[model samples]
Target: MAPRSSRGKSIRQRGARPPQPRAVSAQDLGKLQGLAGLSLRKLEALRARMRIRQFSRHSTIYKEGDESDDAVYIVLSGIARLVCLNRKGKRNLLEVLGPGDVIEIPSLLPDIHHKLTCETFTDCQIGLISPTALVEGIVGIPFREFNEALNLTVGRWWTLLERHSNFLSQTVREKIMLALLDLGRKFGRRDEHAMIVDLGLSGQDLADLVESSRPKVSECLKSLVAEGVVKREHRRFIIDSVRIQTSLRS
Candidate 1:
């Protein structure tokens, strides 16, 4: 038998990273409640299959032109942005997603890859559910349960195409108005009279969203403020709910 080493061993291994604490709980999956109408009872079987990740602000979760995301990700808390690179390599903002939003419905597809980059806008907790688990978690799962999920994937592309076609025909000012209206509906918080969008978007972000330049977007925003359409306060965009509703309908 070999003799034991005489030197005392260190309990903490040098150059080894510390273990990270789990950032999510089984109880935190309520963020997925709307997707496939998931509930605690529905998630019970998949509990062992799920995982969580904590992301810091401005961290890139995935990049454009990547071959695969391979699984579905749900934002349990905080915000994430979808960005695409233009032909000139400028980053264009596609959308900002908050809690409860799924990264892409196509995550259900085994061979699918992302068309855009996803990144955290703030410190975030993300829930991960693999496609394999989605396939086997429930009885006869893939046959019937995947219908609505697949429909969302088609609908998402339809909406994006529709927006692209509509954008080609819009004036710069018109484009800005529609873009603000879309964001207001998607990310806005409401008080008594106003809708506020505070997704850390700047003029450049809006420009990216609208596929315009910063100067053009800034001019349109200033014009909107002058016309009582949308206002900027404390670096957040604000619009009167009642007023914008009328304007949108007109």
Candidate 2:
């Protein structure tokens, strides 16, 4: 028979060990959406119960239909997207998330499956806390500020759906143009003459975001290129913010 390794022998003797909780800092707490303006003492208390996690780009943090309401995930850094797959298995992009964003506040509530999948758009740092710990952690924040933060968080989804409704009246060209402008503002960096969006997204990803077919999006991109509203160089999009805004106004 093969001899047990020293590590295995030690584990058997010592039994299982619990993972240590990661330390949280005031700066970290300040970045959280609804938890700003918290006192140092409160921040310290919450820090005790939090754990940090890292995920590579394109990783799924939570899947749709997951039954466990284990912990709340907060984005400490990098971008993430909420997506849903329909009955036909068609992908629909819901929202883009960044630092200080929570995956879902409602996940803290009991007896609910995750309705949308949360996937990282870039290499991400995330903070996690149990619902119980979270409840105990935020005991002293001002109710008004906390409530307003919740409203704004929920309001963003409503706004996204509202924009989708508004897009129904717009042409495919107009829709892609609007999508480009929005993404540019969120993810683009300003160069000498344009805002460059370098998300490394493919044509299909953009189509998912714009809620249009790839063929139509390709056609609109050609139109946009011809009109000089947008240009592409090495897979990055160069957007003329001034021109697009002016076109929108006109």
Best model per lDDT: 2
Give per-residue lDDT, candidate 2, residue 186. Answer: 65
For candidate 2, list the clashing residue pairs, or say none: none
Question: Distance from true position, residue 64, model 2, in Å?
Answer: 3.4
- lDDT for 68 in candidate 2 is 37
Cα lDDT tens digits, model 2, 38-72, are: 77777777677778877765566776445434678
Query: Where does candidate 2 have its weakest 10-residue lDDT segment?
Result: 6-15
lDDT against the true structure, each candidate:
0.61, 0.64
Highest TM-score against the true fold, candidate? 1
Provide the TM-score for each candidate, comma-separated: 0.62, 0.55
